[model samples]
Target: MITLFRSFFQSKLGIGITLAFLGLIALAFASSDVANTGTFGGVAGGETVAEVGGTSIDTAELRSTVETAYNNERSQNPDLTMTQFIEEGGLERVLDVLIQGAALVEYGEKHGIVISKRLIDSEIASDSNFAGLDGNFSEAAYASALRQIGLSDSMYRARLRQSLVANQLLAPAFIGSAFSENMAVRYAGALRETRKGKVVSLPSALFAPDKDPTKKQLDEFYASNRDRFTIPERRVIRYVEFDASSLKDIPAPTAAEIRARYERDADQYRASESRSLTQLIAPTEQGAKAILAKVRNGQSLAAAAEGTGLSPSDLETERADYAEASNAAVAKAAFEAARGKTVGPLRSPLGWHIVTVDAINSTPARSLADVRDEIVATLAEEKKREAVNQFAEDVEDGFASGSTLAEVASELGAEVKRTGPALSDGRIYNTPDSVPEILNPVLSTVAVMEEDSDPILAEVVPGEKFLIFDVAEFTSAAPPPIADVKEQVTAAWRLERGSVAAKAAADKIMKAVRGGKDLDAALRSLEKKLPPIEMVDIPRSALTANSERVPPPIALMFVMAKDTIKKLAAPLNVGWFVVQLDDIVPADTKRDDPEVATFRTNLGRGAGQEYAEQIDNAIEAEIGVTRNENAIRAVIEQLSGSGR
Candidate 1:
């Protein structure tokens, strides 16, 4: 049966049909039932963790998958630790993916969806992972890749066969799904509907008291919300940087070496002449000669080409090398023509041409004495880079041997830079403008470290420099005394009281509007002074209009029924808003829109995905699945070093 299935697909669809299975198996595990718990009753540790039908997912398989994922992530983030990976739920994600793949494979077997060995071979042969330097399948390369990931050839082939079967089972679910035009129109109408409404904002500034808060009131506010005034943990770092720019006392180059370099690059130093030509091509030699006669008689190229019905762009007018001219004949005439001379009724591939030499530019080569300083500076910079690289290597070796940055700096005759206490947000207590560029990269690397971590060496700018740094002092987060920030506390207290007053006023206005009062009249009755009420049409999507003035209110207007009023807090802490839903304009059903077609295609895809998930869930439930906690815990401990 498997052989018959492969023969049918090969004769009907060829390589294209096999290529479609490339990502289908991965998609089966894209969403998983691993998040749903099953009764933990099965084999012991280091054995099978779960079973779908007759297929078993053992501890060894789960461990291999987790280790592969961890190594891949570690390649990009060298600092990632096993403890951190386990804490972030990486193990659970891999377990879910493995279980999901096993479930699909079981379903395919029951449904009699056979995938032949030949199909699996074809897929593996086409995979670039198994290809050699010459771009052909190599058995040795395939064996090496599997060995690196700790997979035997038979195990790898079995996994590939399972994926092919899973693809065969799930492909039919979405391949033929379609959505109707009416369904698309209805969905688009809801998204395209617009509402006209009026909004009134009660500004908090209007409700502020005339006088500042008393000390007693400020103290009470600060004591109750002390956490708001707390500063986060900060650090003071000290480091020494070794870079090319710090290299000094470089030796000067000799005159003999400078002259030798100039002679070696003699061709590059030689100059060539270029001419700007305005040319018009004609169909025949007689027509070209006639145009050349007119241009020689004081007619401009533009006026002469008017009869040819060609624009100025078609008549080439740019500078080019003599070798780059239109043809051999045109090249000879263009170089020989004197400045402002008209020449050429020359014939070639692009017909006959009438040419004019507009201008000639000439450049002379510079003598060795003229460029001596430039050559010397270039050589000095090259030497400086080499010296800096050697010095950085020495610094790294010293740091590895438990030497302090100060000791390294003393030996190398370099100065050490120290930073004042600064928050993680790059805010310093003092000397804001003097923040060194080296501090940022060092701080980012150490941000994940514990307080007072050991000094380490890091490359700040790749191929440029390295920094040796350690946390000099660390300060945990703590609230400042009220006396230290009394003015700031007083301002915050006033805003809190004003927000209360503004909310009450906005609610009153909304109450009036809901009770049949006009929107404009409700704003006039408010106790606090408010902004002018403006009525504008706002679309649900708001793709075209600038709705920044009252974005939250506009968003609420669409969800509310017509003739309803709601009050909301203003965005960005401005104040409060009273909004009324005046009217709604549904999308026009009679007109055909291009966006509606796009909407239909997207909806069809979503419906197909939901259907596929339902099918997988049904199959999984029917087959029954059981997971063993002991085996799972054992695999997690082995891979992540975490027992839980």
Candidate 2:
């Protein structure tokens, strides 16, 4: 059901419909009735961020909305930072959505568009989130879910009421919309258009200087881009890890314990009956009967199947248990048939099948001795995990009671480990070996912590160990002497010079092509210095920005006038390419084409949404909308946890 819902939501028309109310739904789930304490016309109340018509949008509500939006984004991308969230305009987006919803609600109230209490109650009662084990609405479950998110019953209902009213007001605009077939045909034709072109790449390696860079040239390059050579702040982290694998005192499981476990889970060790089956599906009942008769008369099954004109793959030979077979009738016949016996001309949903049981496999239960060692190892690991968890708790308690990491390690009789100075990006200086797996948590912890702060506890290896670490010393970012980075500077200088030359060559080729010369002819002029040119007919859908056959700038071809030449430098230090548009093939726009229908439906929904937005804007203008800029900025800072 969830998969079905997602498929519906992803359809072309469904996408536009969802966009119309997606923000409203998000705001509804994130909002509460904190604004209800003040009257609709009140001038003073709790801190307010905005006013729609005469109603105030409280600061508390806006903060909750931002936090919810941030959490939703982070749930999709776990590594997203608060700084990145703000930089992506998460706060402004949420505010605009909430404000738009507010405007819709105000307009609804003025026009007397209201949802009944019974309707709201029915909607809440049918919600799956409020359903209990018996699949009935449970008040306790409903209250608990709302409480977990800091929403009261009245607050939740108010948001729902607003959503219902807005839906009612917008339904007319969406339902009354229509799109023409001509418009759909035109749009789909543009999307399915294919372009045939040739690309000639100018490799930068061909333009490399024969000699190494002079000292003066290297020094000059380093002087101009010294900031690029500056190293970020590095930290030396000292830590002690409590590892489960280091527990040596756990006792092995006895024979009796192993036997008891085997008995408790005996069904898991039992194997189902399986058969090796080779089946030949016939196209007709008469053909199947003929094949079966041939097999029964001592002809080989493969030979009989070949007479029916079925390939080896079409025969579908493999091993399967009763449940694993393609259909129930085939499974039952295969299991019941004697080994080396041929059975069927049985009609399944697919076709008439004739099967031969080549082999039958039966598994017998084993004695406890067969798995004694595995059980013993499992018991030992469980004991070790418990011991490690206890030690981790003790270390955490020690830190809480004012003991340093070193002191805690001493108390536990564990050795403290120190890492070499490492940059914030996790690079260690002058180290021959890579960073140990266990030290990853320590590096991440110290990267964000203030210098000389208290030791922090973290799970370095989930379910196996914990690390207590602190930054022992810190080194701020600074540029090293040019002599120290001379090798790197020389490589950078060469790459820069090579890239410039490649672009210059590509530009010359582009100029020639624009002057009526063929692409191959233009490249042949520089044949000694260029690689072989490859041409491919790329459909518009296949011309993605990340295509391996074409550079990202190939997207420019669609926008350029036909028969024009263009040049683009490749990303990531690759060479440049000169591209020319040859011809375009537009899609067929027959009435029966599925793409045309989809495009028509999508365009209609898009037009409806545009009309809806215009309605919202006109409503806002009719009843003035004012916002408190200072309050909004303060709320943003608070949600980001950088409040001054």
Candidate 3:
């Protein structure tokens, strides 16, 4: 999910996504409760962030939270930053969370739910991932965690408390709404057996050649499903960067260390060995003796397995993964023999075995000279990575000595290029295909930095091939005036119209299904009869529409025990989600299929989700959430001008 945060939150403002992901959860404080701020979501100096709901959600808190989350995330993404976070929907997600949190807090208030400090503290203490394995809170670690994402303990704890209060109230309420066993069984059966008749796709060639898609047809599609084409608003930003690689006279790794690293990784540096062999396992020692005696007399291993009441395990293992002393009597004799040689009337616990080595292969062992090129490449990359950091330190010193970017650039043997208005994600300028991964982490740390001023991290951006990045120009995201997207509004209007038609049609079908019309026949009567559907075995990853190549959603479908005849809604980018529950296959663990284990896991998740959703809902219903759009816009604008 943080990976998603990285890409989606990639923005010009260094912290928009990065800091958002870090501290956004922390920001979910009762912003509505933040007092004297007069408005919600405004940025000032480092200390000047505002709040909502009379609660304070500031930059410092957000920063702390971001740091903590990133530190946790470091296990997986060791080199990710707030800039990448925002570029990847990190900021947008935060906004969504802020809205949800506000709404929940208000809802909680409305419902008279009160969360106590004790409950919140207990929760904090109990969350093992947040706490250490020592089973006691390490205050420094906790504080450090909060600080990483830019939060203070006092502020975050309150938000956490409110969140808990809301959860405590709703989980029981949602428990009553959970699916019954009968329902689950029915659902599972349907899913397991659900078959949509095979669809023979009319090739795109058919449409392309026979009937060129008319403008009218495209328009009709657009009209019928405007939601599909209405992409979210995107921004293009420009910013400057400062990174570890922008300095001069950086030190390089010594040759000795490079050699040491190569030695350390020698096992990985070497290729694997392979062998082919044939073996027979006999049910009895006498049976093995019979086979081995024949092999000694010159019978092939395969024929030996067939003739001696022994089956060849076939081109089997030359070496056991672990030594089995019982099998050692047979194997030791076998390996000691040369290839194509027969051996082993050897004794074993599983009986007797006769063996023949067919072929043995050892990968080309890399000689020092043969691997010299790769060694050089490895040593150079390591040297440069280390050197770049050292270079950054030198750049700092150079600045103290009154040197300029040009002088630093010249000294470092790095070229300079000015980037257009681009954001941290590098997507603003149609991110080139050849960008270096090292430069990807941070485009710039401080978004609102002043021009003509030397910033600490300005040279921090890694180069395109090595480590390169540019400063960003950030901007505020505001809801566009309706007039700015009149066509979009018109498209939305069309989708709304289409949705109304689809829903009405579905309602008629539902009524007919209840009135004794067969579900399939009812569907057939629609303006477009169901297309021939496909039957497929799909993995879970293939279920989404995007993975239609794997297991496409059929217009018609079915499952195991119970049955549902329901209307699926018109699909949307977000709103098009539809599920028509039908039939339930009984869960069977003994089945050879792996999906059973998957189903069991899913079942457990279903239980957890029920609890989690209830908590979310209860919070929403209990809290008081209000939006100060203007304030939020101002914050975005203000933060856009600054860098982290």
lDDT of 2 at 160: 78
The lDDT of model 1 is 0.62
- Considering lDDT, which of the candidate structures 2 and 3 is the better prediction for this target? 2
Q: Write the per-residue lDDT of candidate 1 for residues 1-644, one digit (tens) a residue.
A: 11111221232222222223211222111111111233213323247888878888776556545544554454345345555676787666666556666777787777776666756776677677666444556554565445323355766677787666655655445442446777878888887888887777777767666688888888888988886677555677777777645555756677776788678757545675656777666657876777677777888876665424231222322233333335567878877889888777887644566777878867677777766776565444445544554554665577678778789778657888877776554557645653476766555444434445656555466335767777777776567889888888877787777778888887877778778887777777764456677686967667545646546677677778888888888653457777777788897753287666666666765565566666667777988888888788766666543211
Candidate 2 clashes between residue pairs 3 or more apart in a chain or in different chains: none
Preferred candidate (TM-score higher): 1 or 2? 2
Against the reference, the lDDT scores of all candidates come to 0.62, 0.64, 0.45
Looking at model 2, report the run of 10 residues with the lowest lDDT sum.
Answer: 1-10
Q: Which stretches of candidate 3 lie over 4 Å from their true place?
A: 1-64, 67-387, 394-415, 423-425, 428-472, 479-484, 519-561, 573-644
Model 2 TM-score, 2 decimals: 0.50
Write one digit per residue (lDDT tens) for candidate 2, span 1-644. 01111222233223333323332333233333343344222223367788989888777677655555554554445345555677777666666667766777788889877667866776687778776444556564565456434467876787777767666666445532457887777887787788877677776667656578888888888888876677656678787877655554766766777777678757545665556777776656887888889888998766665423342222322233332324677777777889898878877644677888888877676656775666565545445545554655666687778878778777656889977887644558656544567775444335545466778655555435767788888776567999898888777777778778888888878888878887778777765557766674777767543537744556767776778778877764457877777887787767668667667766766777766667767878876789999877776666555310
Q: Residue 435 error for model 3, in Å?
A: 7.9
Misplaced by over 4 Å in model 2 are 1-14, 19-49, 58-64, 74-88, 200-505, 521-534, 541-551, 568-577, 587-598, 630-644
Most accurate candidate by lDDT: 2
Pick the winner on TM-score between candidates 1 and 3.
1
Ranking by lDDT: 2, 1, 3
- Candidate 1 deviates by what RMSD? 18.7
